[model samples]
Target: MSSPPEIGTAAAVQVQEVEHVYGTGADAVTALGPISLDVPRGSFLVIVGASGCGKSTLLRLIAGFEQPTSGAVRTAGERPLPGAGAGVVFQQPRLLPWKSVGGNVELALRYAGVPREERARRVPELLERVGLHNVAHRRIWQLSGGQQQRVAIARALAGDDPLLLLDEPFAALDALTRERLQEDLRLVSERTGRTSVFVTHSVEEAVFLGSRVVVLTKRPGRIALDLDIPLPRTGLEPDELRALPEYGALRAVLSHAVRDAAG
Candidate 1:
């Protein structure tokens, strides 16, 4: 298997002092601001913070789902374009219940102007990559929460985009299922070599999966701490990696940063 790329190596995405606010005047709420970070090409970058810290809001800006109220956001060295090389997996599966699992993935390709024949071929492959091949013919309702999220991930990977943005995609799963899916996601990202920015509340999950983890402050968020996870990128299972001393220390540091920011 090919090695995952180095963190902060190629600059896949950059956000500079961006700010986002909703509503106007007295009713206004600031979701994120003065936030800046770079996600390197083929790296796994995770953002963690307390609720209302703008983790998801910052992700939306990078995914081009929303524009910043101030400053700048760029993807692949250019201004972010909605759904451009930005594949998103939301907390919910958000799949069309009427479509089969493979059909759901195919729909994403179809929307991206992929030909029908190509969609048929690519959908099953993407599903298999996420370990969802057996469920390709299953309906969305037939799968468990974790399986549904896998299908959602398959749909996101269907476009073969350079960047994948996930917002707490496994936050709803049972503990065991979430752990299993995390391993699977790590494998998928490794195999695909796609740069990913994941938003999560779990410091352990962030440390386990990210090449670098960035902790954000409370509302009107800014980077509080950015840490490099120095575990070997190869030949280590997810469980084994968690048991490493470096992993525990990194998690502790992140936990402190998150708690301090929240306080």
Candidate 2:
């Protein structure tokens, strides 16, 4: 199935002076924002920050899991509602251990209102896009951590949702697995050409995945830096991309900004 089209005149996501406070009175903690951003269609936008910098908080607003205390957040020119028109993947691959991998994705398709006949065609195709093959009938727990996460990603893409919200989905994997997943995800994003908002703490990961990167400061999590990554998004190997002088330079700039923002 084709991905959804961008809606209206606004970008895929629009955040205008959004501020989120976690409590009330003197004890209230402001977790994020009083910030704004615009994500164009088909953009791979990565948000990076130190721990406590509210990277995930902003992602939640985009995902409609939480609303801002002040201002507004919009997906496709409307107020975002959880599970509506967005697919989310988290730090853990939150799959049902009892279900086969294909079952999990098929369920997501059902919820997305896809007809049963279509889901039968889409399940394996989605898995293959994420570099998984022939394991659709396997139990979720029987797979490695990386494979489980791939299933999570396949489920996210089930509905052909125009926006993909990922909050550090690769953070918990081993180094090698993480890199492989990154490669696979990069390819998936390229293939789908859907808007993606990914939150991560790793500067390298941010540079590697994003066509654009937003770095957040600590505490109230203001935008510290918003950069457009100029590296080629495709047609090159992971090592070849990383070896470019521009790639290292972008990493250095973001690394220093992250430290400064954390401080």
Instruction: Please tell me which predicted candidate would have the highest TM-score against the true structure.
Output: 2
- lDDT of each candidate versus the true structure: 0.87, 0.92
lDDT of 2 by residue, 1-263 (tens): 12223335469998887888998999999998778889999999999999998999999989899878887788989989999989999999999988899999999999999998999999999989998999999998799999999999999999899999999999999999999999999989998989999999999999999999999999999999999998975679999999999999999999999999999
lDDT of 2: 0.92
What candidate 1 gets wrong by more than 4 Å, as runs, is 1-10
The 10 consecutive residues of candidate 1 with the worst lDDT sum are 1-10
Which lDDT value does model 2 have at 240? Answer: 96
TM per prediction: 0.93, 0.96
User: How much does candidate 2 score in TM-score?
Assistant: 0.96
Give lDDT tens digits, candidate 1, residues 1-263: 12222223248998876778888899989888777778879899999999999999999888888888877778887777887888999998899999998889888998889999888788878888888756778888999899999999988988888999999999989999999999999999989899999999999899989999999999978889998887885899787898889888989999999999997
